[model samples]
Target: MTGRPRLADVAARAGVSMKTVSNVINDFQHVSADTRARVQAAIDEIGYRPNLSARNLALGRAGLIALVVPQLDMPYFAALAGQVLQAAAKRDWVVLIQQTGGDLTVERDALAGRFPQRIDGLILSSTAVGSAELRKRTDRTPLVMLGDRNYQGAAQHVAIDNVAAAAAAVTHLAELGRRRIAMIGSSPGDRRHPRLVGYRLAMKAAGLPIDDRLIKPVRNNLGEEGEQQMTALLAEHAQDPPDAVFCVTDWVALGVVRALRTRGFRVPEDVAVVGFDDIPYGRAATPTLSTISPDRSAIARLAVDSLQAQFEAAAAGTAYEVGEQQAAFRLVVRESSGG
Candidate 1:
């Protein structure tokens, strides 16, 4: 014998069917008192313990909520995940993490009832997938949305006001007397990320003349993407370059700093920089980054609390009230803004 007790073995030892043993273990009323006693005796004799995963599967309730995100390697998401875990622990809810790599198909699949029989709820941190697509499959599950995706109240979402946050970051730089400000991570019509919208509003608010050359569009939201664009910008505007730059994410800002160093531009003195998503690296960089700090812990709190509301509404046979909830944000002043 492998010395590991299985449900079938327990059933055989008790002279009962596997289903009856399952019922006995679960305290299903269908099992007779005599049968329950016999199953208990067998379990004790065999030192058999129920498999949590198997038990959860048989009951169709795992007490597990899913946290789906783009990538855990991203510092912001990793930090968010840690907060979500602590938040879930407070409610005695177990979390199963899923990384979809920000793929639309994977995001869609997460809401497609694949775990309807296992997971009690799901929280998705999405960067892509539109409202229509989210609506088609999300209504059945108790789901909470996170991050900057604007789904127009399609789901219960907890996020920061990206437009306002970005504006705040830029306003901080402008206050520092930096006029020629450049922006990276500009995707003109990508509503999934609202940084572009925020940048435009902030520039206009500061009464700074918008330069088309300063708005660099990055197809990828990675450090290298920012580095490549910043390098080119350095070469293009050697004499009359931008005095400051804003990036959509801290990862991009790190690259911008790298490129600036390679091009011999002193941070804050020559080019003030601001980034969003105050990642860990932002603080430790050569010139610590000034950034808009979205309250991630608050997002985790509101999201978990919101999901609890989702579950309660479902239990009461009422409709889940969905809305766009913006958590607080603040511009964290560090060496990068020279503030």
Candidate 2:
């Protein structure tokens, strides 16, 4: 009781071989039902904790899923990882999360790091690599692309219609008769960057001239930095500030609202503000930020399901019916965006 129980002790207590105990730990379906139950009961009785590293080596599986992301500090990525964890837990899977900080080395390592023998799959929402990198890696191991824009024609991708969603947000603001609309988003160079494309298309379709001054790009999407971006956006339009704004993500919208408050501008009443990714906090913000709500939980569920199905099929030499899946998005209106 003073230390962790060993596998041999549990195996002996269960009247089964240590291999059987190992199979039970890995959730391998090969073990007889009766044997599995007996091992489970023994494991429960002795409170055995299997050594993950050695067990993985023995089973040729790390028994883990790595969620590679740019930064967890951003609410969207953090929320994505949370959803992945929730979904993985339903299938009795454990998750190992790694932040890439948008670095190529870290991102590559996060994927290649699990090669030969590590995690069963990877769910990535990174800015570090492209579809080619994803495609190359998936051939070696199962991979599910979460957020990056380009789909390299290899692994499954789960994402929202960013262009359509951004246009919808802007169209909603325009319908409110807010002529001067501004936007806040992330780095512009990313080929898969959808926010920038969405912003421009929306402005042009609305017959609004593409004013570079009104568009503000940031290095990060944390909620705290929203105010700073908003401040700069306002400064750029100081002579004739925009009557409305469309943020690339909800975190930016939250900050924009805060910045407006600091400057004595009431949301919706002064400058209607719209945001993307209707994260949990979006609904709870003081004014209830109006934004786009992509089916985050569904995305997580599908990604996990795809990886699990592939794993089972490969193990059994049977074909898994996993195909490409996409998450739907809805425009959520609230007090902040004059909806």
Candidate 3:
């Protein structure tokens, strides 16, 4: 019944004082749980939107952060960017995205622009840019390094234990009686190389010989490349193909499945398959993919929380050190791996 629902309106509706509603909005932490719940319900019922712009202006913040990924073409990065945006939304900040194609020049250009001027901070998922190159930057912008590579420099970082996760994937396949398992989809000079090392370690531990032929390297991590590699692998070992395939990513697993079906092999029955990332599509695939799934929510939360902390320190002209933040991952057993 008004132009816009105000804090006073919510206070009146909730039968609480304006100061109590303000305390609830600001999250003062001293408010009673019952009071907080009442105020929140009133806010929801009236669709009362907080003036984040005014808040940002008062705090001298831009209310914006850039989430820069190598490329949106990869489902992993696309999904991650979405998760980061959602996480930022929970903190009342906006997230804009930029694609660098993993090009050092593009990444450098973004850094040179003095981020934190237009935007408050940046979450960079760099593939080509190294920690050394990032170390060269002198700006005090609040930054958090996300997936792909490990940055050992000064800024904040959030990633999964790739080596451990990969080893777990291979170990799962081996435990399922999958001998002659092929690990495919690797690009040279990519952070995913650790996964390869993990695979090798797992195979050796299982007393299985590491056959070079079984370690297929695709031109890219796309599904089509996985399909191509699978075709060649099937033809190369038509008489005696590998019993299982562990792809570096879920996209590649899709292709592996396609190749197997084309060559008339029943999944799990003829050749078990496992893929990483555990993207949503994997769950709905003809044979659900069994793979390593990282806790993206944890990663996003850590990255956002770290950046927020850094920003607060920078604004206060105080010392701030962003430590390494790691997310947990789990091996998901599904139909693809005969689980």
Cα RMSD (Å) per model? 7.3, 4.8, 3.5
Runs in model 2 with CA error above 4 Å?
Answer: 1-61, 114-117, 135-139, 186-192, 316-324
TM per candidate comes to 0.80, 0.76, 0.85
Deviation of model 1 at 104, angstroms: 1.5
Tens digits of per-residue lDDT, candidate 2, 10-51, equal: 989999998888888878888999999999999999888777
Comparison by lDDT, 2 against 3, better one: 3
Rank candidates, lDDT, best first. 1, 3, 2
Winner on lDDT between 1 and 2 is: 1
**C-alpha local distance difference test of each model:** 0.85, 0.80, 0.85
From the highest TM-score down, the ranking of the candidates is: 3, 1, 2
lDDT of 1 by residue, 1-339 (tens): 487999999999999999999898877898888999999999999989888666766555566889999998989999999999999877667888989887988888888756544677889987687777777763476888887768887778788998889889888888888899999998555544577778778889999987878888887668999999898888888889999999999999999989998878898899999988999999998889988899999999889888778876877789877998879999899997786
Ranking 2 against 3 by TM-score, winner: 3
For candidate 1, what is the TM-score? Answer: 0.80
Going through the candidates in the order shown, the clash numbers are 0, 0, 0
